[model samples]
Target chain A: MYVILVYDIGQKRVGKMLKLCRRYLHWVQNSVFEGEITEVKLKELVYEAKRIMDEDQDSLILFKNRDAKWMDKQIIGQERSPTDQFL
Target chain B: MYVILVYDIGQKRVGKMLKLCRRYLHWVQNSVFEGEITEVKLKELVYEAKRIMDEDQDSLILFKNRDAKWMDKQIIGQERSPTDQFL
Candidate 1:
């Protein structure tokens, strides 16, 4: 599945979460990450994310799509980092 | 349906997109706007967004969920803004 992950975490924990996510997916934007992964990998990412986050303080939103073609994307301004080399 | 909209637009056009989105949903975070919207309203939002965006430069990603319950959200750090008063 293709997953879009975004998170709002404390300054102290942001680094950890970033590292955790980067290890599993592409860091497309600040506080945002996405890419394709197996069900098992997704679960593993969530588990690791849960362990790294302060549940009461940080918030994470994950959107899963069967494939990227199902999504309609529009790009207008300055392009930051590319979505992903593989995507 | 519930929609989660995120955009990476140019500085000049972002303001316009923000205004268009704020008129319909809550501005939860930078570049992220989301809320419950009807199919008609969703189309309206998309139409307006397309007009405001620089098709070649900006990127918009919309995630639709029938309901928030289908999502697993995790919060870890400082909360910037409430998701929405009603949600």
Candidate 2:
């Protein structure tokens, strides 16, 4: 499936969360990531994320789609980190 | 269209951006918002966002879909703000 993950982590653990997410998905912008992954990999990514997050203060949201083509994306300002680097 | 808007704004201007986005979309979490809006309204929101943003330093991304049913949302941790409050 294709997924877009957005996170709001506590300042102290955000760096760790970023590193963990980078291993599984493309970092699209600050605290935002998106890419295609198998169900197993997605679960693994979420497992790691839970470790880096404080349930009381941090939030993590995942938007899933069967494929990227199902959605349309637009950018109005600087593309901090382009997800289509290879393409 | 149903749109999910994510922003990474400089600290100095983030508050203004948040206030502006709230008027057009549901606040799902920190720096993230989603809701149904007409094309004209989306354009207006983008126009206002551009004014509050520094093109060189900030980034705004919009993910649009024909309907929210096309995508799935999963929250792993705290949902800072619930989007389906009315539902």
- Could you say which candidate leads in TM-score? 2
Worst 10 residues of 2 chain B by lDDT: B78-87
- Candidate 1's docking class is acceptable
Alpha-carbon error at A56 in model 1, in Å? 11
Local accuracy of candidate 2 as per-residue lDDT tens digits, A14-38: 9999999999998988888888889
| Model 2 bad stretches (over 4 Å) | A85-87, B85-87
lDDT of 1 at B71: 46
| RMSD to true structure for each model, in Å | 4.5, 2.0
Model 1: runs farther than 4 Å from truth? A1-3, A8-19, A27-30, A35-87, B84-87
Q: What share of the true interface contacts does candidate 1 keep?
A: 0.38
